[model samples]
Target: MTSQSISTDVYEQAAAWLERLDNGPLDKLSKRRFINWVDAHPTHKQMFESMLITWSSPTLERALADAKQTITLKDHLRCTPAIRWWQTAFICTALVIGVIAWQLTPNQPSAIVHQYATNTGEMRDIRLEDNSEVTMGSASDVYIKFSDRHRLVNLKKGAAYFDVTSNKQRPFEVKIGSASVVAVGTEFNIDRGQYFTDVVVHEGAVEVAGSRDDKPVLVKAGEQIRITGRTLGLVQSIDISRTVDWRSGWLELDNESLHYLVERLNRESAKHIRIDSPALNDIRVAGRFRLKDPGQALNLLAEVYGLKIEETAERYTITRLP
Candidate 1:
């Protein structure tokens, strides 16, 4: 191949990877594939770095800043009859560079904070400024802030799985109430309950600590820890599958209480579930159920426990069999 053709191929691949990075941090498999591609050829790495530097150039930043000051984005687009090829490319490159700049910049007056939330039966995947990926569960709320020294996420409600990108200079932390789980680069899931929080690590390790703890507990892969108020629970080995199943639209229950099951079901179901019989809340059950179809899950639960479910317009009430 001619040098020109080789350069074109490299540019195309680099642009594709940049687009993916813009969308969000890649999944584990995709990330591994990306690393392999970068390592396969020195030319590929050089081209990618060149593109990044070009996009983040001060000239482009000044141009964009001037355009923003003069007119709003929508107005600017409306005023332009047709965009040139280079202009279109610049716009796209600017977006990716903007994210990178936001992440890598030093201390400012304040960090840009982004908040994300999911409604009932809804899930969301978010890519942070630092290229960290967060998979939020139904009825979840998270606030993110990235600075030169730290990448912070506050889990206000529900559960989320975090796949953090490594940056030794800046550690990643998830804050739940007065407790925090810290990691340099790792995969972990945090579920915030009314009175407690659970942290499960699938890859690498994390330090878990509460406000009152003197030392943070190191929870490694396949291990789990729980924090309640100012206290941290003992670390224990757990099935990794339990943390991953939710991403595939399945909830794997392992001898969890009926109350806990119902709470999870409520997050994924429009028609809420309520345990009318107080005694049923303490009953233990275990099964893998489909989160997408909560009605079916409730039916299965009713069958397995020999209970009755009273259906209403707004909710399903679980009660003892008549």
Candidate 2:
């Protein structure tokens, strides 16, 4: 083969490799090798660049969509020639696009994608392009995708308060587990935890529906609703402003038990607090406490209930005094 042909083959291989890398973690040695290769020759770099752009072209994306449609049936995944051929074609197209996106992206210190995560007892505020804002709660990870047609956010895990900008033409939506919360203009909090998914509406209105085949229920201001994967229940009334009091460094514990309060505090603060006594679950506490300083709250808890607070490497425990 001529030198030109060899270079073309290398570029093709690079594109395929990049597409695969998009789906998984990159090995350090392989990444180093690719970097060195790109730096070695100008012609080789041009070839790689050309290949990347071609693969990510609109034409390639359309081809991939066509390929996806062909493999939609379960029977297609079985050992069959037709399915195998379609998969091969689809994978090839995807590689072409993947290479273009990866190679074209600037080589900066933040090479890999940076995912946003909120730690226990910490809340993070993120601003979106539409001038909307999201206040994420502890242990939350959210991915945002904005386009002309829609503003989408995937609440992969945890909870977040979304103060969305009103856009009647293109609605804003959040996907959590099997439920989706849609709003044209609203401020709401969506919680996805072990028990159930909760949507607390603070402003305007939001439509909550199951991701699968269920119809959505519309929730308005000062209302909250909980949905178990399949069931969408009634909307309960709430003190909208006070419900999200944590945003301003205050925890509104309205007849909440010491057990639940600890859970809320753990989520609101960067501390992992555990209640050692089961009896504390029945001890109801209602008050507004500033979340800025957890130490002061601990001191108050100790003084009120004569409880002992112990801190360990992994967690903090509160136990009743003997």
Candidate 3:
């Protein structure tokens, strides 16, 4: 068959697949058949992906809804060849309009901004409009701005775990200072520290860019990267479970500095924690402690490291044992 004929046939098959997917999940046999069809030709996969993007567009949905008022979509799909041709033309027109509208908004700001935060000792689970989920850690803050082309999140303070839904047409990005993490469909945790931003990918992969001008580093699953200022650190292999232990109200440490431990503890502690002895800041400690009880956590640290804790009306000071 000629290229033009193959493309037209593939486009129709892609539309049919889109309809089937929209109805519901396919059975195992149907899934296998669909996979085989997708693998049969490169054009099949490309056409299906393009159709998926158009199928999920709000403009196409609106156009379909309007057409349903005059003629049922099911009838159009299953009926005469003329009806199918009309349906295809209508959907193509809607896609063209959507593309034009998107191009016209190159400089347009997002219409709405959504902000979410968690208080001291508080953790929150938030569901975004795109059906993505975010687990906000104690004293964490995030601002979400979604447009037709992109979904942007600014991590203002502390940490958050994102379970992003897959959408190739719109990229999901998390901004931390001058750095940003971009992903298509993945789960990852981001911790914004005082002087650095840490990213740990639990599933799939993400591209980490220290700045817009710098080349993006691909951090895959079972990997971690720290962005200090505008520089991207080495990508290191990590225990993903240990990094996300905070979701269970536990802080798991493995030879982390005392300064790092104290800084994390202060986020959930009602009374402030301060390191009085500068020498103690570099002390490496390891343990799993409950985030709900910062005092007990500190006491355990002191016991293990042979440190002293002085209590006042407001804060607890950690010093070297004298």
Error of 1 at 157 (Å): 0.7
Weakest 10 consecutive residues, lDDT, candidate 1?
Answer: 100-109
Show how many residue pairs clash in every candidate, following the order shown. 0, 5, 0
Q: What's the lDDT for candidate 1?
A: 0.73
Better of 1 and 3 by TM-score: 3
| Per-residue accuracy of model 2 over 1-322 as CA lDDT, tens digit each | 9976676567555555445443343455554455455545665555555333222333445644543454444452555543454355455445543432122234412111123578876779888778999998876777565656667676766778999999999889886644689999889988775446778898999999864345788999999998876478888999764565556777776675686567656765555788887877668777766666665776687777677888777767888888
Query: Candidate 3: misplaced stretches above 4 Å?
Result: 1-106, 241-244
**Per-residue lDDT for 1-322 in model 3, tens only?**
9876777678667766655654555655665566557657767755664444333433335544454334433442356543453355446445543443222133655234556778988899999889999999999877676877888787878989999999999999987755789999999999887878889999999999975446799999999998987789999998775564678788888887888888889889999999997888888899898888999998998898898888888999998887
Task: List where candidate 2 sits over 4 angstroms from the true fold.
Answer: 1-115, 120-122, 228-230, 241-244, 257-259, 268-271, 277-284, 302-307, 312-314
Candidates 1 and 2, the one with greater TM-score: 1
Q: Sort the predicted structures by TM-score, highest score first.
A: 3, 1, 2
Prediction 2 global C-alpha lDDT: 0.65
TM-score of each: 0.64, 0.58, 0.65
By TM-score, the best candidate is 3
- 100-177, model 1: which lDDT tens digit per residue? 333222234335555677999898999888888999999987767676687877777799999999988999988775
Worst 10 residues of 2 by lDDT: 105-114
